[model samples]
Target chain A: MSDTKRFLYVNRKAPHGTVYALESLEVVLIGAAFEQDVSLAFLDDGVFQLVKKQVTTGIGVKNFAPTYRALGDYDVKKLYVERESLAERGLTEDDLMEVTHENDDEEDVSSIEIVDRARMAQIMAAQDVVLSF
Target chain B: MKFAVVVNEGPYTHQASDTAYQFTKAALEKGHEIYRVFFYHDGVNNATRLTVPPQDERNVQKNWSELAEKNALDMVVCIAAAQRRGILDEGEAKRHGKGEGSANIAPGFRISGLGQLIEAGIQADRLVVFGD
Candidate 1:
């Protein structure tokens, strides 16, 4: 196997109420330094982590939702959001924050990819390391 | 195959530690290599040697220590998480000006930074995380 491995970070929980979301994001930022192929999958309640208009002011917690937008700058750009998860939660692509990364080859092309649960499972099975949080 | 396990919850209060323990044991039984078992968040509590459970209950700390000793596994408790929860090894205790007696890391477990966890992810064939 190659020394450079593909890493998939699986997010299955919500951003708040637990440390998993924020802590997982910390890991992603750190992992980016390794320069390995890193992709993030937001499923189930994890989709909430990318939801737009996240207002935590009354809750007295720093809103970390903006961090997702910064992932592109770190070269961690493959963000796969499960379609079923969003639908089940009564969410749509419009409900999530716009996570875009400037394409290296074409500066104008930038988008977040949405996949079905089956596609997500395929991606999970193909990863060299699946770090779930 | 080489595997790295991450335990994200403490003992007794959650089944995460128990599930990780069982999975590690099974992987060993199948002759798979364990690259590392990283304890993060509340999972650092599993490294404490000070836990005293009831006689009838399984000592989660003891189980992990024994398993690590038997398999020569690298059981690392995240230093950041451990320090936050008072789960210190002798070296950390002394370095931090805490008495040696304040250290509670069980045998075969080490205290390290989150870099070790990221390293485990890079090196292992599979990185499995057990959490609440």
Candidate 2:
């Protein structure tokens, strides 16, 4: 398994309305088991998945928002959030929870990055495999 | 070229699975290798053997089973998603407290983890996803 292909998971759905958001996260967690270059791109309504204080008690579904915070522990650290999507939804970076990963020095580095539309396109175009959810 | 397919929607509910089946069939017809076919989310419904579609219409589940048999395709249904949707093989049905020998999984499709999809993407030259 020496192949180390670049994989980009493009998510463009809301968190609870449908299963795409959770489905995307599930793949990201499992994909972490492989020795491949993996990155997550959140755009459109998908930005709502990273919002802080996600409570699903009223909906009777297990609130899985906390799982996003633990993704870095599995080496799935690159999570890109589009700035245009955030603005379109009337939100700012402060509305989302902070996700961080530890470096060689054991210092925690922020994993959730807010990137512009053009940079997001570049990141996606450079991938060997792009799976849209 | 080596190809991998991901079906994110169910059989008749969405055209994703049918489209994926056609694409895989066409690829094979053109002499392309199919690495695997991973079913996720509601797409797990495509692996149910108990489904009885109308005689006049196309049988989605039956179509996949026949194609897999003909092509020797590796059709995998996400274990987590299948359990959530009540689509289980013999082992899963027994472990989940169902009656004796109660199994609903179709032939040629096995219950597996999401890691299979990652492996397909890593190994295949192209990973095609058909979904809403």
Best candidate (score: DockQ): 2
Model 2, span B1-132: residue lDDT tens: 999999999989888988999999999999999999999999999999988988999999999999999999999999989999999898988887998767999999999999899988988989999999
Model 1: colliding residue pairs: none
lDDT of each prediction vs. the true structure?
0.89, 0.92
Per-residue lDDT of candidate 1, residues B41-96 (tens digit): 89999988889999999999999999998999999988877887899887889999
- Which residue runs does candidate 2 get wrong by more than 4 Å? none
Q: Give model 2's DockQ, 2 decimals.
A: 0.88
lDDT measured at residue A128 in model 2 versus the true structure, 0 to 100: 94
For TM-score, the strongest prediction is: 2
In model 2, the clashing pairs are none
Q: List the candidates' TM-scores in order.
A: 0.89, 0.96
Expressed between 0 and 1, the share of native interface contacts present in candidate 1 is 0.52
Residues A1-133 of candidate 1: C-alpha lDDT, one tens digit per residue: 6778888988989987887898889888888888889999999999888989999998888788899898988998899999999999999999988877888675734447889999999999888888888
Candidate 1 docking band: medium
Cα displacement (angstroms), candidate 2, residue B104, comes to 0.8
